[model samples]
Structures are given as C-alpha cells and as structure tokens.
Target chain A: MSFNVIGKSVIRVDGLAKVTGKAVYPQDIYMDGMLYGKTLRSTVPHAYFTLDTSKAEKIEGVVRIFTAKDVPGHNAHGVLFKDHEVFCAQKVRRIGDPLAFVVATSEKIAQKAVEAIEVKYEELPAVFDPVEAMKDEIKVHDGTSNIIYHYKLRKGNIEEGFAKSHVVVENVYKTSMVDHAFLQPEAGIAYVEEDGTIVVCAATQYPHFDQLEIAEAMGVPAEKVKVINPAVGGAFGGREDITLQIHLAIAAVATGGPVKAVYSREESFVAHSKRHPEIIKIKTGADKEGKLLALEAEIIADTGAYASWAINVTRKSGIHVTGPYVIPNVKVDAYAVYTNNPFCGAMRGFGATQVPIATEQQMDMLAEKLGISPVEIRLKNAFTKGSETANGQILTESVPLITCIKKVADALEMA
Target chain B: MKKRGKGIACIFYGTGYGNGFPDVSRAYAELQPDGKVAIYTGATEVGQGAKTALSQIPAEVLGLTVDDIIFINEDTSITPDAGTAAATRQTYNTGNAIKMAAEELKKELINIAVKELGLNSDAGLEMKDGKIYLKILPDKCITLAQIAAKQSEPLRTFATFTAQTVQIDPETGQGAPYWPYTFSACAVEVEVDTETGQVEIIKAAHAQDVGRAINPKMIEGQMEGGFAMAMGYVLYEDLGLENGRIWNNKLSTYIIPTAMDMPEIQNIIVEDPESTAPYGAKGIGEPVMIPVGPAILNAIYDAVGVRMTEIPVTPMKLLQAIREKEKQGA
Candidate 1:
C-alpha cells in the first residue's frame, strides 16, 4: 500500500506551457478565410419581434446575415430542457435571446451589420419574481405552467413531531443572482473541414455534451462535429452549460468558412447562465435539550428564462435542507419557476449553497432559544456513524462533521 | 471603533456525479519500446493539477517515474472518456482506472521478467525504476529495455472504473446518491470597523477530510484557492442586475478579491483514507468552498451583533444593518 508518487507533490505537467504564455486558447485561434460572427440580442425582456435584415445585407464586407428561418435544423437546445432558442423566431422571452446573427469579414463589420439590422418588437407582459411567476398570470412561456419543476420529500409525521417540540423557529432567506465572472469571456471558433466535418474549439467544461448538442442543432450527426476545449481561464460551473458552441457551428456551416465569435464582457454577462436566485422558507422545532424534533422547508428558485438545471437544483435543495443535522420528522417542497429574467443554472455550490444560509441561521436560532452555544447545538444534532440524513441515506463512514466542527471551534478558541 | 470576533461552520460534500448517474472514468496505458509510458484519458487539466495527479498514479503502479508518463487528454477524438473533471472525481475515479491499467501492464512485464531471468516463481520479482529485481537476490535484475528489446509485442492495457452508488427514491430523495463524501470546516477571525461597516478578516483556518492527499501541495493550492473564491463570494462579488439585465457586467464595475485582499490562511489537511478510492483519496475540490461563506457570515455576526443574511455583504448593507440595530436600541 506504499506509493512513491501517488501522494507526493509533483510539478504540474502542463504548467510550463501555460506560464510561458504558449498556451493557445480558442480566442487565439485564427484560420484563413475566417468570418467574424455577431449576435443581435433582444432589447426588451419579453416581446414578439419581427426582424428585417434587408438593410444589413447591403452593408459592405458583410458575408451573410442569418435569422431564425436560416437555421438548418433545430433552432433550440438546452442542457436539461431544449427550450432555449438558437434564434428567436417569434417571441423573445428574455433579453439575452438571439434575434439574428451576422457574419462578416471583420469584427467591426459584423458588429456594424448587427446594429444596422432593423427589428420591430411588440412588448408583452413579463413576470420577474419566482413567487409571482408561480401565480401564472403572465406565463414566461405560452401554454405551459410557470412552475418548471416541483419536488417534495415526506419523512415522519410532521404534525406529531412538531407537537413534541418545545421551541420552534420560522424564517425566510433570499439569495441574489451571481455571475461566474470567469476571466475568459465566452469565446469559440468553428469551421467545416474539407472532409465536410464540422469542428468546434471552445472554452467549455463538457466537450462530449457540447459535441452532441452542437451536432443536433446543426442538423448533423454527433461525429460530424468535434468540440475541443483549450486553456480555460476559469469555470466555476459557468461553462457547464452551452455558451458559444452552437452559434459558432451555425455560422461556420452557413458561411462556408471558419467562424469565430467572442462575447465582450457585457455580452458575456448577458449570454451565459448565472447561479440560481432562490427564496427559502424554513421552520425548525427542537426539544428543550436541543434535540431537533421536526423540520419543514419550502424552497422556490427563480430558474429564469429556461430550465437549464432547475430540476436538479430544486431536488438538491430538497435533499440538503437540514444541513448536516439529524431530524426525525421532515417535510420539504422545492419548486423551480420560469421567469422573464436572467437565466440561472449551475454554480460552485449548486443547490446545496443557498439552503445552508437558512438552515445554519435556524440552527443558531435554536441555540439561542435553548440557552446553548452555537457549537453545543450543532454537536448535539450532528449526524454520526449510524445517523440517517434527510434524504434517508444511512451514513456508513467518513461522517466527520462533529470532529471538524470541534477542531474549528478549538482553533477559534485558541486564536 | 473595531471589535474582534470568531465563528465556525462545517459542511459535507459528495464526490462524483452522484444522483445515480453512471459516473465512470476510463484510462488507457501503454508501455513504449523505449521504457516510457503513455496514458490517454479525456480528463481536462483546467489548472487543477489533474495531469500531474493522474500521471503520478500510473507511474507509481508501473514502477516508473512521472517523467516517463505522457498524457493525451482534453481531445475527445483521441482520449477515452474519463468523465468531466468537475465534481472532484479526477483523483478518485480516474486514478483508479489509471492504476488498474498500469497494474495490468505491470503484471505482463513481471511475467516476462520471470521468464527472462529463468526464475522459478514470479512472487519474488518486483518492478522498480524500470528494472525487475528479485527481492531475495537484488543482483539478479532485468531492465524494461531488455524485456522490450526481446518482446514479441508492445504492452498495452485499458481500464474503466465506475462509481458504486444507488439511485435515490424519486419521491423521498433518499438512497446512496454518491459513493463517498468529503467533509470540511472553516473558522474565521474578523475585526469590524464600526464606523465604516467594513469587516477585516485577520486570520482564517480550513481543515478538510480529503480521504487522502494524492498531492499535499496541490490539495493545499485547492484549499487556498477555494478560500479566496469563497471570500469574494461572501464579501465582494455580486452580479448587479436590474430588471433581469446585468448592470455591472464588466469586471471594472464588479469587485473581486485581489492578492492584497487575502487574509492569513492556515490550511490543514486531514487524511482519512477511503477504502473505495485510488490510494484512498476522496476529492476535496468542491467541499473546500461549501462552508466558507457561512463561516464568514457567522464571524461577521459575532463581530457586529448583526446577521447579514445575503451574500456579497457589502459595506453599505452592513452600515444599514448597524443603523437598524442602533435604531432599535434607541
């Protein structure tokens, strides 16, 4: 069981090439006869829009201007739900929706052409709040309910358990929308090879997933398109979803040459997904000795314009609502709602991050009511070797919450 | 006016895809005629030291130095799928596959060495540093060069390791969602500027159960890096949005912690080896950031006697909380 290098610190194999500035990112990619691509985004949050590219087609050096009618195959794709449009055909549900794409010989020409393209938009009522969206008065998407997904977890009887409680605390918590803010703005380049195969090199987290999605959108087989990720500046779950992969593929195939698109910092913020903004309501009850008796939680997440990872986030929120604590009776419901807002998806913590702010605060509240210190209350309710989580999984090993808290508490005391 | 206070938070994180996803990592190892090794996998480096940790595993198992290992990664057309480098599964799942492939190649080499040396049993033979030596008779050794020189075919093997987990109950959200979990706790000491509502982090300590440290220095880098990112998430970073559109869309408008903003960090690595992982390593990439925001929030509460519930607890927000508390007292 001895190892010479398994546990030893060795120099990174790719460090020298990166530190020496020899790393070739997707942005650095340049091919002869390449066309720069630019997207015209919707100005209004929600509206029915009609695009007119006749004026833009006359712009000098503009190769082509493609709209929703120009897409070869499927115009929509998403990580979880295929609701996001490559080019909006009728209605723009979010401000980031792509209305048209411009391909030109130069970036300036493409941008200028995008600005020249005329469009008329008829505004529609939009719902911005998840709770209000749940009312379904103004649905983000027509025909379907605003609630994208709802998950429920039922444990022991909440009524009986709450009746046995000596103290109860109720609270509501709100988490703000945060961007990934990765140093590298979303960038990619795509081209159709001589062999009629499409190739895409981009800053992405999942190349395989990107390949399949890109191929499907371009009306080609998965093998026809290849995705390669060069040196990424940073991706704290920001690159998990599709960025510029498909847009470049469509432009490349349509322009009959290499196509490159790099979002500016402002466009990058509007283009990519952000961490889900959620509102969590929690109620926890405990006995006089600080033994957790009952827990009830309802988490509503603003999934924004699409259901990218909304279902996954809501389920995870339901699973970890108790926050490393042991409770007998627990009931939880998590809902993801569609809204005409900035779309939210995976981030570093996923669903587990926001719920902790509520649960931990609830823990501290219980501590105050029980006349015990924060450390004592957490230790009292901490899951041990044989404890069962709110998700009903029995802990077998490596359950070290108590030990870790004690060490941190001890370290803080020493400091 | 400045006052000092401390707070602590502990949290658990799972490693691997979890949620009953078929999480698998596959690796291919081949021994070249020149005694070097080549490993092919789709694990992206992503500045996470994946290439280094992955190289170390095959090198350790095949009795070769890390310099002898060549990695072909990040190219889907060539490398086998090792699953994405996210979820901190590189060292655990991919490490196991690389080890298996290297061990398979080593078994073949040991058989060849036994036959070449005219040894009676292969049990006494051990490969170390590109040479096969008899433990009982160290002088009787054969180099990999000699074996490859006389070999009929090159040695190559493939391995795939799948995480063992159960699907959770759809309604209850209960089951073996993840194979193994990583636990981490962070404690922070903060000084609050009562007038300005700016909290200064004096020192911070983070202790994590990584199951095992494949590379202590790299794990330290992950800890400190996660701390810095989480610090920004707590105190500085916020994507200012108005009416569903980003207001501070540029980095110049948004704020993040620079080198000068980092506090003194005490990185502690707790090694509790997991039986299911490669060399007993459970990944620590994500767990390192889970408890950080809560820890700093608790510390701010302790210092200012106000609980700021939202993230990016800006100075203005703290000043408002302080004023609200004062108004209540008045």
Candidate 2:
C-alpha cells in the first residue's frame, strides 16, 4: 500500500521546537508574582507525627503554610485507589508522605520555610519486604491486610500435563525496583484565572486526568479546573500518577496567586513511583520433542506504600506468564502486596517486562535438558495464528510470533 | 578468559488499558474558512512523536498535507479527552478517533460540494489536493475553500473511539482482557569476561509486528531506544533502595546506560496490519522493550553456563554467581 503521508517519514511536528531549544517544558515556565511551593515529608517511614508550622508561617517571604486542616476537599488521591494522602493527617505510612506544604515568594524562601517546619514523630515498625508484609502482622495500612490484590489464572489440568511431560524445568527469578529517570524532574505552574477557573500547566502524560484530580482535590466542579501540558521531557510511565499538579493547584487557590513547584533530583526520586520489584517462581514442562506442555508460576510484586496500578500490573503479569507459546495446561498466581517501601506504579513495560526474565530462561533450560537448540525449541511451540493464550483469549488475527522469531533469528544469522 | 554466545527471546503484549476498562479516545475536527482543518485532542505528545503520527491521520483522510492541518492538543478545556499517552495507546486510539472525525468532516464537505457543483451523485466524487472532483470527468472540480465559503453552517465534527475488549473473569482469570495484542522477538550476542564477570553486548537484532508501519523511521527510533532502556534494566539502573529510602538517588550514583554503553542495534519491522487499527498500525512503544532484557540474560547464561536469577546484573553479583558455579563444578 502506497500513500502520501501515512507511512512516509515526515519530520516530527515537535522536531524544530525541540532541536532549537524553544520548547517550553514545565520547568521552563515562569509567571509574574508566582509563589514557590515545597512539600514537607516524613523522615520516618511509619510514624505518628505532630507538625508545628508556626515558625514556617512567620518566615519573611512565606505566603501560607498548609496542613491537613487547610485542604478543603478530600485529602486522598490515587490512580486506582483513593488511599494516598495529600497531607498526613494522623499517621505517616511511608517515608515521603507529605506532612505539610509551604508556599513562599521565592524558591529559596520556600526551602527555608520547609526546613523551619518542625515535625515530632513516634516511629512505628515498618515492613519493607513484600513477602514479609503478606504476614499481616505489621500492616502497611492499619486495620487491613497488606496483600492488596491477587490474580489467578487456571487453564488445563497442571498435574496431568506435568505427568505427561518428559522434562520439567523450575527456577525462581527476581527483578529490581528501577526509576524512570526522565530528564525533566516533576515541575508545574498553577494559577486561578480572573473568572475563578484554576489552570495548571505541567509536564504530564495525561492532562485531562490532571484536571479532574486537581478539581477533586480543591472541592470544586471539574469545569472549574483546566490543565495544559507543556512539552514533556520524558515519562516512561513515571508521569502517569500525580506529582506536583495537586500541590501547585492547592497552593495557587489558597494564596490567590500563581504558584509553581519544581522537585529537585532527590525530591523527584522520593516523590514519584518506581517500577515494581518482582519475585517470580516458574516451572515449565515440555515433551521430548520440545513442545511446551504445562506451566505453573507464582509471582509476588511489591507495590510499596499505596495501591497505584498494582491490580492491573500484577494481572498483566499473570496473563503473560506463559510467554509467547502455547502451553495447554497452566496455573499461575500473581500477587500485588503493599509494603513500607517506596510506592511502585507504572513503568515502560507495565508488568509484562518482568515475566520474560523468567519464562525465557525457563524455555532455554527446558531446551537444554531436552537436547535441543533454543531457536528450534521456540519454533516448535511458538503461537501460530489460531493458538489460544493461557488466559483463554483466542488470537484470531495478527498473531505473528513465529514471523518475529524467524526475522530476528535470520537477522542474527546474517550478522 | 572471555566467552561468546548468542540467545533469543519472544513476547506478546496487549495494547491499551485492557481488562475491559473503557479505553476510549475522543477528538474534534473543524474545517477552517481557508480549507484547512484543525484537529483537537487531549493526547499529550510526551516526546514520543504522537503529534506527528496523529496529525498524519487527519491529513490522509482530508486529502491534505500535514502542514495544512492545525494540531491542537493537551489542553483539557479546548480539546476532547484522548486518554493518557501511556499504555502505548495514542497512535491507535487517538489516531482512530481523529480519522473518524476527519472522515465525518470529509463526508460533510462532499455533501456541500454535491449541492454547490450540481453533481448528479456523490458516488463518483473524490477528494485530493484540496479539491473535490468527479472521477468520471477529468476536470469537473471545485476547491474545498469554495465549498467552505458557500456553506451556510460551519463544518465541524467530533468522534470517539472505544476499543473492544472482554473483561477477564475475576475468579477464573479467563476471557479476553485486551484487543489486538502485539508480538515481538529479539536475539543478542554477548561477550562475557569470565574472570571479572563483566558482560558486553556485541550486537542485538530485534523484530516486532507493528501491524503497519506508520513511520518506519520513528518505529526504528522507538525500537532502538527501547533496546537501550531494556539493556539498562538488565545490567544497570538500580535504584539502590534500603528500607524504603533511596540511598543512591542522584544520577551520578544511580547509573543509567550512556551512549557509550549501547551496542550495535538492528530493527526488523513486520507489517501484519491489524484490521481494527488505524492504517493497520498497532502500538510498538512498550512491546519493543519487553524481549530485549530476556534475550540479553539468556545470552549471558549461554556464555558462562551460569544462570542469573536476578537483574541489574552488576559485575559484583555476576562474579559471585561465577564463583559459586565454579565451586559447584569443582
């Protein structure tokens, strides 16, 4: 199929602006009389804290100091659950939980005020491991189990398929928690228009969701809020959740002036979400001909302090546990557990990135035990056009695993 | 001693907010007075070339050049909600929505042309290069600007596209949670320094079923960038967390792969067009990264005959594993 523009490599619409250093990222934005905002987070991971903001309020350029009491609307916001707190009212669940927000006339003043705010806390026991958090003795969230969600998939009978298998390979795999490390740190500017509409300009993956969230936090109608996205540096799923949008909006509305907040590199690391650290135990069985027969896998993921996209991420891991092959009999259990560790949310691959670290190694192990080559074994069991996934989704079209495998293999051979 | 080996891996990924989430994208198309069209959508570009790719959809449908269309996006009040740019969904979801809105606007323009030119029917009419013409007659044509000037009412359209997916049953985890899953594979060759346990990637060959190639160069860029990120995921880029606090929060301490660390990369794009997608294109953003990590790990195992069960396989961990393997072999 030939066309004028669809397939052609037209220059990027954002190319000139980006290359010319003319693109205005959130950090590059500045407004007249804009107050700088900074957050005061908890020093202890789990604690009951008493905040004294009197000194911060008395700072020379300090405009306003906001605590849990100043928030007009709901203090909680999250992508999946409304459990994350805008300000820690009673107990701090994680290390970076916001205890207070300080707005000042300058970034230096804001930093000074944030440092002046005194927090006295009584530390509590914290569980950092997902497996240990599952014991429910020390709950990440009080009065609830730490096992946030569990997803299970059952296909054919596992015992029978394993019994028929000539060789079985089992191993445990682990992946670490990593940062998105997008070039731009979290930054935004928020101000109220003359007609009482709050406008937030930020770097984000979704501006509409930000509008809704900012409105919800301000106890106002959605129509009263507007969000504009400037040129984003990078996201890689890091900007999918809330960052400085809500705090900036709240500060702007309270002070009745334009407010801006830009997280430093350290603050950005402490504030945003990380990729889930996963532990996967997988067992694969194949026949003498190297055809995959059955699989049993268990995955436990640390979702950290709050439920972000844990339900979807772990469920995705469960669905793709069998990899790109037809495993007739499969049993998989995936869990997203909450711990006192840094919160884990969306990343580039969501949950599918971690499973291949296990499934692919299992395939190679099975191939080695069966006296077959890696490429040959995968070819024998790769999903074709009519293959059914472990989750019972029948791929009717565009199932091109074999073609991709062959293309890579052929390219490698040529190289 | 240094050892060399090769390994391969494959993966399949479902696009959008699957599992029966109402993955919807909305867009608006307004025909300007000068025959130019404006597309308004809430899809943020996020440095992924979404604006370029999405602008092409309306341009293709309206028989105009990319420069002829005004791309307005990411303002909540002005543009309709095109969903988030994550989930690798902008091109497929927002592209389809823009295409639909543009198609509707095209139909309205053809109707105006039919009445203005006194055409017998709209069946033989074709739009190309800013003109609506009759295919039967070589020269019976009217400019879109002329039709715009003659219209009594303004020409505008709004469209919404929702991907079809069945929710997986909560208990059984059965049912189709996603529509139009994308597939990919990768092969990598590596050299492992046995004494120090430092592994260097020699070359990487990757292939993805992109459904259709909207822009082959952009797809290649995505593939190459995804490979580098995935390589970092396996070898470097550790957050260094201890008891919930990031010890190495600075960029200097938490090492990401620099340009010097990248290996030679080869991208193979397979165009197996998805029938439901825009121009038969599926998202390749996230799928390209999924297979590279495993392929690199598999190559490491093949090189040294030691299986690494954990990631960000720093030289220290690899050395420890190699020592343990040697102890067992002895």
In model 2, residue pairs whose N, Cα or C atoms come closer than 3 Å (at least 3 residues apart or on different chains), thus clashing, are: none
Candidate 1 runs further than 4 Å off: B116-120, B138-142, B145-154
Instruction: Give the runs in model 2 whose Cα sits over 4 Å from its true position.
Output: none
Model 1 Cα shift for residue A173 (angstroms): 0.9
Candidate 1: deviation at residue A354, Å?
A: 1.6
Q: Each model's number of backbone clashes?
A: 0, 0
DockQ of each: 0.62, 0.83
lDDT of 1 at B46: 68
Report residue A257 deviation for candidate 2 (angstroms).
1.0
Compare the candidates by DockQ and give the number of the best one.
2
For model 1, residues A71-99, the per-residue Cα lDDT tens digits are: 78898889888998888899998888888
